[model samples]
Target: MRSEPTDAERALWKLLRAKRFSGYKFKRQVPIDRYIVDFICFNHRLIIEADGSQHAENAYDEARDSYLSQQNFRMLRFWNNDILTNTEGVSEAIWTALQDETSTPSPQPLSRKGRGALEGAHNG
Candidate 1:
């Protein structure tokens, strides 16, 4: 990860930091496995990414997302432009995702080995 955050990341961090967002704790530039996520809320198993044009249809990101999903992390990706311009809408979307718990299980950390074993058993 870069030492300096982009303008958009800085803006979003203001909204998410210090449990300011409805008491949900979020960490920035967090490492999960081999990938460094932009923002993450461990309590919700949620990962939020602020993407630039380079990330459009990115194969590496797709693969990374798949891997994280298998580990029970939900992804919410927003464009830098959108995050900067439509800040309220972006915040609303994140709030909706956080409140909608029916689709996701209670937050729990799963080790890589445990996730692989579960997938193997399911496939077998």
Candidate 2:
């Protein structure tokens, strides 16, 4: 997938790659559970998908997103056309989402120390 990215994917990759977007590292063609996502920021548990016309309101996409959501991963879908034509807007939207400043706060990572303390308290 890395070698043969769509025009839109290639364009977006430029912005997402090398931790250029707010210093968050994004991996391409990452396998999360059973699904392969276009771009994923592991630290944020965010998945970015670039889809073509066929994917508009696609049932498969919906199901896939549902599954990802259940697994505590946030999904963002963009039309291929939008990525190609409105690269800046797409990048800005992604940046905003990453910042967790949107209406819905993005998932924040749980610290291991906190998790362990909570677990110990519950067990006690």
Candidate 3:
């Protein structure tokens, strides 16, 4: 893991650290098996990644995601630009993912449609 977090990671960490986000605990720069995730909530088996342009269409990330999915860990990946520029939107998305009950111990990862459903539930 990098010794220092990026600007986006630092910003998101502020919102997630110390149970500031909905009373859920979050840790940064955590290791899970062969991969080190940006942030993780063990209670929900959730991992959040603050990604830069290097992550776009990354095959390694896809494989890593598949591995994590098999372990019943839900991943939320946000672009660095989005995290830095639209903090509220990123937080809301994270909140929706955290509120997702359907992610419980599932072998399959949460699909885009599933996330959209969650968003609809919140908006409705």
- Candidate 3 lDDT at 119 equals 31
Q: What TM-score, over all chains together, does every model reach?
A: 0.82, 0.77, 0.82
Residue 81 alpha-carbon offset, candidate 1, angstroms: 0.3
Score residue 55 of candidate 2 by CA lDDT.
Answer: 62
Q: Candidate 3 on 1-124: residue-level lDDT in tens?
A: 8998899889999999999999999999998889999999998888887777676556787778878887888877776666777777878888877898475432232333322223312110
Candidate 1 TM-score versus the reference: 0.82
Each prediction's number of clashing residue pairs: 0, 0, 0
RMSD of 3: 5.4
Could you give candidate 2's per-residue lDDT for residues 27-121 as a string of tens digits? 99988777889998988777887766666446676677777776777766666666777777677667756776223323232222322112211
Off by over 4 Å in 3: 104-124
Say what the RMSD of model 2 is: 13.0
Where is model 3 poorest over a 10-residue stretch in terms of lDDT?
Answer: 115-124
Best by lDDT: 3
Give a tens-digit lDDT track for model 1, residues 20-115: 999999999999989999999998888887777676556787778878878888877777777787777778878877886555523232222322
